[model samples]
Target: MKLQAIFVGLVIVALSLFFLSPKVNSLPVGANVTSNTSSNWSAAIPSRTDAGGTITTMVLDAQSQDDGWKGYVGNISGKFTLDDASGYSIYDWSFTVTEGEVYISRAASPSWSTAICANTTIISNEQNYFGMTAAEYDIINKTFNETIHQSFRVGVVDIVNSSCSSAFTYVNDSKYPYINESTPFQEVLLQTGTDLIYAALLETDNEGFHTGYTYDFQAIVPDNRTNGVTTTYYFWAELGT
Candidate 1:
């Protein structure tokens, strides 16, 4: 029995290793591609793998019966470095950042090509002062800096970090990309939905500006207030010089 079992295992391994074609006809059963961004997976699992040969969408964990009215506030920074096996910074490897992107999202990797977040301050899609449940408005009006959001649906992106001496934004806004311009203090009405959301990470640097920056950017995310379930927003970044 042992000999037979061993032979079967070898055959299975051999088939998995060498018998399959270089390209798979379809993703193996139960293949869980966790990325739900609008763009299809590149190089690995193209749309042809699906039966329809069309782009497949992996929708997020949509939730209802809960208030979409919670807030996150934070600063984001990045380090572009090459590390040795021991993780020591290899300074000679050369690293510089011309710009950086920060994403406040419920998805681990939001799409760079798609502006999944639906809020923007450019032209008011939502009015901050209204379009809220009385409960939500009352709660925010009572606690958060209502002055930041003002009575506007969307505010200008006027983030500043010129030097260690200038005022910088403490948080980021959940807004659309593409048409977004880099500024700080872009405020919009509290968006309502359980769909996965993300925001453009505005750059705040000490490039001739006031500065006390630990990180390169700041952002915020809205979440569901379901009891016993703490919302988890993923923060992702990319840097280039």
Candidate 2:
């Protein structure tokens, strides 16, 4: 009788602990939150594997419920980086929108425009704000306070270490093999369904303006036709140095 009583007590204790665990305390599966000034929005990175590289995505949305699927209405932001074992140097990066009306936002100042298809002027005093050493960025700030982002939708951004030679090499050299060096990085930011949602930003190396080798944005519109279940927004990234 005592043995059976102890076994019953153990089961009750285990059940109590399981229900009180931190995992159970997480945001309910189908809840959605948003933050414009900060990256407090609900986001996730879906895993993927490929020959060229492994790609990951950081997704954000405002879903009515957490059905482990898509947000009813929100945005997707993805960043790419080199796998430590890949042994690669980032020569260029690109952002492609396969579906929905997606826009990109790279500027810190809210006043800066967030148009994806337009060649907008960037007004900021911070040189290489996205990526660079404090001292090096200071030097650039002292030398040329502001620069222009040439009109580009897909292509390479110039490296800071080289005398604009790396951009030419990546664009012209068959070994490196890249396209549209004219497409500026600043122009890659996309616009979303619920205004321009900017989060999941990756700073570049000291020698580069951005850390991410590539960035892709996919905005999935809410599906009203379904039985209140929205499809997940797809955000993908291909990592390289």
Highest TM-score model number:
1
Q: State the lDDT of candidate 1 residue by residue for 1-241, as single tens digits.
A: 9988888865534344424435422111111224332222233332435677577778555434324444333333345454444757756334444354444444454333333224333112222322434455433323223223222111222223221111123322222222222345333222224223333333444221123323344333344344555556665444434
lDDT of 2 by residue, 147-201 (tens): 3223222122222211111111111112223334332222132232223222111
Per candidate, the number of residue pairs that clash is 18, 16
Please give each candidate's TM-score: 0.33, 0.18
Runs of candidate 1 with Cα error greater than 4 angstroms are 1-98, 109-112, 116-135, 138-182, 185-195, 205-215, 226-228
| Highest lDDT against the true fold, candidate | 1
> Deviation in angstroms for 184 in model 1?
2.6
* Candidate 2 segments exceeding 4 Å error: 1-123, 126-176, 181-241
Instruction: Assess the local accuracy of residue 204 in candidate 2 as a C-alpha lDDT between 0 and 100.
Output: 28
